[model samples]
Target: MKIAVYGASGYQGKLVLTELARRDIETVLAGRNRARLEEAASAIGLPDAERRSADASDHEALVSAFRGCDAVINCAGPFTSSGEAVVRAAIAAGCHYVDTSGEQLYVKKIFDTFTTEAENAGVTVVPAANDGCVPVDLMAHILADRLEPVEEIITTHVVVGGGGMSRGSLRSVVETIDAIKAGGLAYTDGDWHPGVPARRTAITLPGQSEATPVMAFPVPEVVTIPRHIRVRRVQGLTEAALGDRLNTPLTPEIIESLPEGPDGDGRRTQHFTYVLDATGIDGRRARGIVQGPDTYGTTAVIAVEGARRLIAEPAKPGVLAPAQAYPSTAFLDFLVPHGIQWIIEDAPAT
Candidate 1:
């Protein structure tokens, strides 16, 4: 299976390349910076990896880069700007498309506009193929089966350690904050409602030292999951520490003040834990916990494995979420052998 990766020099790009190498799949690394692309491919031990120069923002260049590839994995972010162009190029090139887009608007737009075209083209287009929807998608599937009439679903993500964020990721964070400040709308109460950042709230994780404050944010998975599952409400939260020792709120000012390069100390180790809770009409509930590495690395792991499945399995052509594209058991089975742990529990009715 031959795959072309856009933004193939970023942190997530390198990790995905590494995972692809482990699976012995051929990859073409395409991005804006030729030098960075070469460096990342070499660092990941893919000496024979093909290199192509293409500006992600330029539609013509993107189309040329995607031509003749069986699949394309997009790690480019701020998807609000570059996503449509890439999707159009992938569709024109007759390739399966997958991305790590966490922007709700882009996901919805693709579902509405390109889903039919992709199906007609016999290509599979998957958005938010990373941790953004995979964990929550799995949780929602689990709860949908256990609960007779589910009312609401909430997912809280607690990420620890600063694992070297890339420029693309930083830019996405800034854009998302800007949108929130402008009073964006989120689906709530069975309708699109105005949404804002978290003021301040404390919550405890299973293996954490103490309770920490988490900021509620709008993520694509929150909107994506509810479309498949019958639920009245769904939300997502991202919680991180202020520093090495204190848990500080992720205020807009702080998000604005983040430095550009060398995001954190080289010795820094990162951790993440997600709690998924679902409530049903009969008072029965289900909760699941998933823990893993830094955000970028985890995303790469999911993307690479997802692509491998697409190559190795018999998959129908269409846009799908992680949980929908691959069987939940098949997906989770691949992760466990790679050191990811999942804990699932069912609560007795009270």
Candidate 2:
């Protein structure tokens, strides 16, 4: 199956292309930069992979690039701006679609606007296919299976490396923060409620030497999972990895002050560990953990693996999150050989 990767010049896009090539899948690299796309294709040793210049915001260009491809993996973002257009193009071209979008607003828009269209088009459109939604969605489903009447779920992400954010990721962060400041809604008290980034707290994880400070924030998973599972409360924490310092605080101001950079100078080998916890009505609890390196690489892995399965087996036609479209164990299994560690643990009852 031939797949087209949009935004093929960026870090995540390059990783996606690399993964697809590793699987011996033919790929068409679509992006705004011809030189960068060619460079990435050459780097992946797929010099003959088709290259097409297309603006992600241009529906006609995206459609033209997507034409004749079996599936398209979108690596472009802030998806809030371009996601719908890509989905439209995919539907128009009768191609399966997947993306790394983590914007809650855009994800809601996809569900509201494209669910019927995707179903009618006989194609599957999967969003937030990365760690943000996929792993947590899987965890929520597993937790719900073990306990009746789950009331809440939380995902905390502790990412150490890939310190420099891509321009698209940085833009998404700024927009999300701005929306929160403008009284945007978040899932709370079993419903969508107005919320903001509150405060920082220290958290100690198993195998860690000290408590790390994390910013309690709302990510898209918190908004998406509750719709599928019987959860009333969902929240997420994005934290900086801890080193020698104990209780190093990552204040709101510090998180807001992160540099939007030409990221190559920073340390390339970064690590991440995320814990997903859930609470049920009868006091039963479940937790799942995933650890990996290079946030961009992991995101690409998720997207590539999703596309690979979609093209190979053709999942049911509908718009879906990763967890809904693929079996949780199979998805987690795909990541194991790539150096990702998955663990499920039960917390002792108090």
Candidate 3:
């Protein structure tokens, strides 16, 4: 099956192209820079892959780039500014769409604005189908459904030792820093409240004896988790310093001054864990923890694998959370060979 990798020359996009190559999947390298796209393909040993120069602002070019593909894995973002055009192009091309966005606002926008048109075009638009979004959503469903109609679902992400941010990642930070403060958005009693506190200060992640200090940070799961489970509330948290780091104002010049991205060895040094807790109405609780290596590396797998699943079978069209598009168990299990591990267990009496 043929898939298109938009922003194919960027760090994450090239990683995705590498994953597709490993899977022996045919791909189209699509982005604004035809030279960089060609370089990316040659670097990945896919010298024969078609290179399409489709700038995000050029709608017609984007559609043409994706026209014959079964799906498009969009790796171009700070999605807030340019995402809609890409989504529109994918739908117009009548192809399934997935993107590696970590922005909550972008995720919400896709679900809100594209649902009708995506369904009408019979294309599944899965936004934030990446390392940060998908696993947490899937794990939330796996845990929350067991205690359906739960009072709350809390998701925390702990990342230890990773290469510094890529320039593109830094750009996303510049795009989202203001909105990410104070926990992004929280789902409460059937309504989403923005810029709220996490109401939690410390949490003990799985396998840790001491609790790590945490603060509310915007995570895409805040938009996704409540959709599948009957939880009255959902909140997301990450390390306190991480949440605080958003305080550092990022400018285009500052991002350009940073390193291009991590090398393969630096990427391999990253390890991430998602701890999802679901509390039932009766105060009973369960927690699911998904652990994996390499944040950007895993994202490549998630995006490519997500595209493969969408193209493998048709799902009811429209916007879908990652778990909504694929089975939690199957997808999580699929990551077993990728140095990923996870488990669900009863939360200790509190």
Which candidate ranks first by lDDT, i.e. highest?
3
Best by TM-score: 3
User: How do the residues 60-142 of candidate 2 rate in per-residue lDDT, one tens digit apiece?
Assistant: 88889999999999987778877788889988889999998888778878877988899999999888888557777776677
Worst 10 residues of 3 by lDDT: 174-183
C-alpha RMSD in Å of predicted model 1 compared with the true structure: 4.1
Q: Against the true structure, what is every candidate's RMSD?
A: 4.1, 4.8, 1.3
Off by over 4 Å in 2: 161-163, 180-185, 188-191, 196-204, 208-215, 240-268
- The TM-score of candidate 3 is 0.97
| Residue-level lDDT for 276 in candidate 3 | 85
Per model, state how many residue pairs clash. Answer: 0, 1, 0
lDDT of each residue in 211-254, candidate 3, tens digit only: 99998878898898877788898998888878556777788988
Report residue 99 deviation for candidate 3 (angstroms): 0.4
Residue 37, model 2: Cα distance from true site in angstroms: 2.8
lDDT of 2 at 77: 75
TM-score of every candidate relative to the true structure: 0.85, 0.84, 0.97
lDDT agreement with native, every candidate = 0.72, 0.75, 0.87
Alpha-carbon error at 288 in model 1, in Å? 0.9
